[model samples]
Target: MRFRPSPATVAVASLLCLLVGLVYLAMQIRTVFSDQLKQEYAGLVLETVERAESARDQVRVWQQLPVDHPADASGYRTARAELARRLASLDALMNASPSAVPQVMSSALSADANLTDTDNLLSNASSYWRAQRDANSADVRVRTIHIARTLIALAALLFCMLVTAVGMYAKRNRLLAGQSFEFERASLHDPMTGLPNRRKLLAALEEAAATPAHQASIQKIAVLYIDLDGFKQVNDSLGHRAGDEFLIAVSVRFRESVRKADVVARIGGDEFAVLIRTFSTEEELADIARRLIACVANTDAQMGIGHVRASIGIASFPDLVDDYRRLVAAADDAMYHVKRSGKNGYAFVTAAGRSAVS
Candidate 1:
């Protein structure tokens, strides 16, 4: 006779699995939010650095003006004051940042000292400012990598949890008959947007990449990284309540814009990702990109947000890259390229080449 576990044993095991999964899910969500805060803080630091650079540039330009010129002297004084104010702000921001990088802190202090030293203002301030800016930029890059790794790990762990939960459910099906699995499904979706979350999107990518059927049938997998331009300005001007409304409206538009088979997800604040499993040619992808962009632009206008647009970067799988992380990174890099050149556009990244479409 085959030995079998008792129903009570299965019940206990199922409960234990559910509890573990919930705890892990909560921890992962907390980590994701924490990483987001870090990213935002880093963004604030970068913005401060840019403002400092601008003030420094203004001082330099004013210094070149004739020393005896009364208007030039007035402008120089104003620029110097502005630079000092900006430096104070930067210092305060650094102090407030929870994870302020040591190198960045040192650079900021050095830059402040150099800026304040009248004797070295012209001689060394520029160099100090540049050093601070570069250090902060490097810090941002490091933080980004850390966040990406955290997210990937979280996704993997969630996948494991899902598998365990499914197995347990299957084993206890008779005992727990008619029990709702809604909680499990809800954990994988975004609460606000009613769409798949980052964890779900990554899991889908992994599944598509691993499945032999997908490999045989799908011609290409395209990942489009979409970011809303001027979203911050809108949020600032219209308040966060309006901003939330805007996001909801845009999320709806995103869902409507994509095919039923494609996956659309809000990966971060004002950042979305679309995964297309089937596409015949580059033109097909381009058409989808254009439609998505138009959808966002039209929605922004309709919602009374002034002319917000999307900057998208497309990365194709197998043809351009094989790995999931690299594929996403390539798309992110291409999106930044569009942002740097001009907002409100799309670009494609592949092993062969890159092209931008406006």
Candidate 2:
């Protein structure tokens, strides 16, 4: 049969997608902020270089005029102010720099400081034509800032790819989880009957018995071992397809007749089991057994599905040795007694003898 996602699987997938999408969003935002910070720092570096160059040019003009000229002093003050502005820009970049970018920023700052020294030397030169123009260290710093900006761009690109990859992985895992649940459903459950198969039932029984009765925190356990009667004749005459439909109907009735907390399973073919709890008396046990018979008998009367009667047997804790091995043994023996006495009745073994229902 074709599979659809169960409600449980769908909810889990949605939660996973939401969490991954949120993580991806966080990554994108971080990259954007990183890029913006890098751009602002690059602009500040360029501004520093420009102001330093302008100050040196003014100093050159002052040297050409006169050492004692009023305009020469003004030119010197302007150069100094430009120098102060360059220093302020440098300080700001240093303060706001990311820890990861410290090495690059430190190297660039060294180059910028060397260029400022050159500008200061130009201001104090004795001869106008003998100004020394050495290596373009500040320009190299500017190129390095451009290279640092490229790092930001590259980081953003890589972050985008990383987010995309993680999102795809999350979606793939969600799909696989859904597929696993589908496989489990097909394996452990009888699709038409909606009851656990023999394998699953046996496993459940084993797990239950592995824990002590005291650990169960429950007292007085009761088991209803059920086998449907006249099922084969119905299948042989009405066809297997009709027989399946009948079994489905019977399965629904069987479930409805029991307490909600009971463990019900189709052991194989027409045999079923129910583990009912908290039955502290024989009357309480017999009540449930009678109800099971009534459910099948009424279902047969109403649906006419070829004698919808069930042979049921009951066994309880303490009386059945309070262990899985003995409890199953007691219920099985009672079920055999029910089958032999008369097919459409219920039985429970006692210390005296078997008690069979009329």
Candidate 3:
């Protein structure tokens, strides 16, 4: 059989997957935007580095100019203006890297205030800008790889969610088609012994009664109401936990004694009801009741409970009771008779001064 998860399990898992995927996707998108901003800053720094180099070349040209030449005055003023513009550009770029480059450049400019030696300052500024550019590039590369992996992981999560949705759809279809009713069955079943509860047993009786005689293979129905003997004493002596285990053990044996189509139900604490859907003769029903009694009687020594037996009351439809609804009540009354007149025995309901075969 194919495995099917419960509806609640699927719902919780889907919610968790969606929550985690959304949070991770949001973080990755934010990183992508931050990386873009860094790239822009790195580009601006590169432009500033070029401007600084050009300014350094211009300074060298001014230094080589003839000091006493006729064009020396004009050439000096033009070179000074160009150098000032480059310095302004470098200041703007310094914002991208901050404190270190700007502070070093300012100190160098002051030390070479006469413009006699600026190569050291320009070289230092260029080196700092190059370092900033390289660092930004490395960061972008690493973030790119990380974002790629994040996308792949998100894709995988999406695929898993798709598969889950498909499974949920298939499960829904199965339920609609009446192929599976585990949830419904669970509601109608005893959690302790995994047997049908009183509600399920009643429902089965109703369905059986509703069936047409021509459609139903077996037209007869019987109910056996069983009460455990000395069960309360076991609970009092060995504790409730042991009593519960003993009940489970007894239920298993009772289940084994019945046919596959028959239902064994736990109607109350220390009380059970079995539905016999098909039986050929009254003797067959007696043999089943005897087997059930033997099951409980033989289990006492093995469970260390010491002599716990069953007092069963049998009721059949169209024989003891006229109505199907009266079957359980009639059987319950017969069981009490056994309980009053010495427990650990079986009795059948009486009708018209005749006892239905035991």
Considering every candidate listed, which one attains the maximal lDDT? 3
lDDT of 2 at 317: 65
Candidate 3 TM-score, true structure as reference: 0.52
Where in model 1 is the C-alpha error above 4 Å? Answer: 1-180, 211-219, 352-357
lDDT of 3: 0.78
Model 1 lDDT tens row, 274-352? 9997788888988988998988888888987776899999998877776655777788888998999887999988576
Sorting all predicted structures by lDDT, with the top scorer first, yields 3, 1, 2
- Scored against the true structure, residue 3 in model 2 reaches a CA lDDT of 85
Clashing pairs in 3: none
For model 3, the stretches where C-alpha displacement exceeds 4 angstroms are 1-182, 213-218, 353-358
Worst 10 residues of 2 by lDDT: 126-135
- In terms of TM-score, the best-performing candidate is 2
| Number of residue pairs clashing in candidate 1, backbone atoms closer than 3 angstroms, sequence gap of 3 or more or interchain | 0
Q: How far in Å is the alpha carbon of 30 misplaced in model 1? A: 68
Tens digits of per-residue lDDT for model 3 on 247-297? 899899999999898999999799999999867776787888899899888
Model 2: per-residue Cα lDDT over 85-183, one tens digit each: 555555465456554322223332332345455554323321211111112234445545655655565565567556756876788899999999988
Q: TM-score rank, highest first?
A: 2, 3, 1
